[model samples]
Target chain A: MKKVLIAGASLTKVGDHWNKSLLDLAVEAGSAALKDAGIAIPDQIVVGNMFSGFSSLQENLGAIIADSLMLQGTPALKVESSGASGAMACNVADSIIRSGQANSVLVIGVEKMRDMEPNDAVHAASLGESASFTQFFGISQTAMCALLTHLYMQEFEISRDELSVFPVIAHKNAVPAEHAQFRKAITITDVSRSMPVSDPLRLLDCAPVGDGAAAVVLCSENGQTKNAEAEISASAASTDSLNFFQRDDMFDFTATRRALAKALAFAGLSIKDIDFAEINDSYSSVAALSVEALGFSKRGEGVRDAKEGKFDLNGKIPISTFGGLKGRGNPIGATGVYQIVEAYRQLTGTAGANQVKNAKTGLLHNMGGIDSSAAVHILRRVG
Target chain B: MSIAYWRERNRYYRILGSKCKECSAEFFPPVYKCRKCNSEKLAEQEMPKEGKVMAYTLSRDIITGFEDQEPMIIGLIELQNGVKMVAQIADASADQLAVGDKVKAVFRRVSVNGEAGQIFYGYKFVKIDK
Candidate 1:
């Protein structure tokens, strides 16, 4: 197998990008990643996005991005798996490198959300779930998470206040992150008191939607690139039932577990070797379920571990080091690539104030729907 | 949009799910293959109308088409045959509902396209008073 190295990484600040269109954000991030890779052209281009059809009424993104970047005639395509689109695109880029199909690939994940209304945006993002069974009756993805939250809390005997630990941690780390959306710190009480969107899920408990783009350059040994220091040690993906309630165990994030276990095996490293992680903390319940699935915490104990400072920057197995989906902001498909960019930053010793000490290895977990689709990746620093 | 829902009439109207002929296991919202025994031989089965609420949520983040049904109460209910499904809870406020409360599926109007559009119907759950 060929080695996939991170030749470049870049991201637009996550927020209401009323000034930029979807293609505009893609171009900005793509150009920066190209500049970072020190390459004038790439062997291939892959874009990851969700709901461009619904939100922007646009499609055929692969050709559009290649054309916008003025790199026409290069093979380009789009890969989408709802919220997991970003990491899934990277996974495809890795495959392209391993198969000797492309030596260097540009992977971009972008989303333009501010263009649509709140209700419409919710509907579009919820396309990740079942349409007939779940959405037909107007069930939003947040509602599905809400239903799961109630079950998880009831089964675990956990209170709503206790679940705020993950968001609090995310917000705290995001405070110093330059590209993060919610840079201000938030307290547990703040999370507990925020207006409720779905029962048991306060406004603070969910990741805010925004328009942003993130990009990365994957290069093989045969590719021409410079100033690269991290390699994708392992990449794996798996899927569970499209509907969360249909899974045999709602609390068990089977997709994440399978994907992470596979990734760890491929990397030949134990969970303890991971200095930090970028969790898909789109919601408090999701964050808890995700950490539990990653084996960073036992079932029903993710929030408890967070309260005890176990996931703190100075503690064992720090997560969401730059605020993650909650603190850093989520642009749907772009979020995973942002995590990859953040991981690359940490591995390159350039995370600034949010850096984990001696961060030699990192784990990134990104999922679509309610852990219905999952992708796990491991990145290692190279001297 | 109602035209899109025309094909699922049986599933929406009668709570028609699927049962595994091989393992005798059943599922709601149907399944292509048996989840229990992985059997492809499945039979169309009407689910028991009654079940207990496994969990519920009062969602104010209503989807675009569901604005009229503001702050909807959604529940995860386990039917008598051990099949689980999510459905809207009707005629019950959050204060009156509790986990383990019994609910039964009822035919109800789910949505309407507009003033002249078709009326879509589906099964929602109502709390069974003691």
Candidate 2:
């Protein structure tokens, strides 16, 4: 397989894009990426979207993006893996380049969730749940996560203050997030006092409904790989049961653990080797639990570490420096690629305000379909 | 809804599921497709209403329709049949919840979707008497 590199990347500020269509955002980011790489539109394009049925009621993303860009018949393909659709798109593009199927591939992940009411968007998002088990019972994703948070607290002797720190830190760091969806800084008290969505998950702890898009360019390393800034070192994905009922460990993210472990092993590194990380923090407690499952902190110790300022910008190990899904906003399909783009920015010293000091190595973790699918990648600065 | 489960809705509709007759893989809402073996053979099996709390959380802030309820408890329970599912925690404050505690499902108000103008109702779990 050929070595692949991220040649160029771009993104629209994640928030309510009421005036923008999916194609509009995709074209904007796609053009910006090409400009960044100093290249014209390539021979092929790959568009990744999670909820096309709800976003535009149109499933033909490839043709839509290509038509919008006026590059009809450019051999476009659409890919989806629930919310991780973007990252999965990246994996597909990388594989295509590495396998000699394409010289260059343009990947765009976009979602227009604000087009519908918040509840409808959430209901569409929860479509990933098993229709047989979860849908019949009507389980909200927040409630599902809240149940796990409650169990995690019980198993770890954790307190609300500990769990509250995650959202606090996420909001605090969002100050540097110029275009983040929710830029207001919050405190642990704010999180605790925020209105509850599901039990134990205050409104402040959850990511707001958002709309945006992110893009990246990939090519083989040999023939003019679009001026690489960072190398796609390793990407790994794993799956668990779609229904939460079949899992053994309610608090432990089995899929994340396996995916991260495999990715790190492939990269010949460990959590300590990572200078910074961008995790899927759809909820603050979920962020804490993700770090715990990644073995950054022992089980039940994540909240404690969080409470003690361990994940702050200047802390020993900072996470979600972009405010994460909590303060940055969760834009469904674009989230995973957004996280990767953030890591790329930090490693390249292009992240103006939120750049981690001397960040040579970074990691990105994104899960889709209620922990049923997870993807992890270790990125390195390659100049 | 099963005719039997619907008749028992006032108390709490605890739907039971069984494994595919050919594959032996269990499902919660009961299904025709055996996820494991893809066998098109299965049977309906009612789950024991009694179970232990597996995990839970206390939500503080409201989204849209739930603006009044500041904090609500949600939990997942493990039944004797080995099925796990999420339900709202009733008859107990957020402070009283803990993992592994015994609980049972009951009919309760679920949520307001903001469109239907109807109060969606479903089974929620309550702490069992010690």
| Local distance difference test values of all predictions, in order | 0.92, 0.76
For each candidate, the DockQ is: 0.85, 0.34
> How do the residues A1-383 of candidate 1 rate in per-residue lDDT, one tens digit apiece?
88899999899999998899999999999999999999779999999898898899988999999999999999999899999999999999989998999989999999999999999999988999888887788989998899889889988988878999999999999999999999999999999999989889999999998999999999998895674699999999999998887777889999999999999999999998999999999999999999999999999998899989999988899999999999999999898899999999999999999989999999999999899899999999977
- The weakest ten consecutive residues by lDDT in model 1 chain A span A219-228
- lDDT per residue for candidate 2 within A1-383, as digits (tens), equals 57667788888998988898877888898888767766576767888788877768878889878888777878998888887787778877877887788877888888888887765675667767754344444555676777666666766777776778888887877888875888888887889887767756778878888888888877676634356878778888888877655666666788889999898988889788988888878777788778987778887788788877788888888889888888888788888888878888888999888888998988888878767888887888995
| Residue A176 accuracy (lDDT) in model 2 | 81
| DockQ leader | 1
Q: What is the lDDT, from 0 to 100, of the residue A153 in candidate 2?
A: 71
> Which candidate achieves the best lDDT against the true structure?
1
Return the TM-scores of chain A for each candidate in numbered order: 0.99, 0.96
Instruction: Give the CAPRI class of candidate 1.
Output: high
- Let me know the DockQ for model 1: 0.85
Considering just the first chain, candidate 1 attains a TM-score of 0.99
TM-scores of all predicted structures:
0.98, 0.85
lDDT, residue A172, model 1: 95
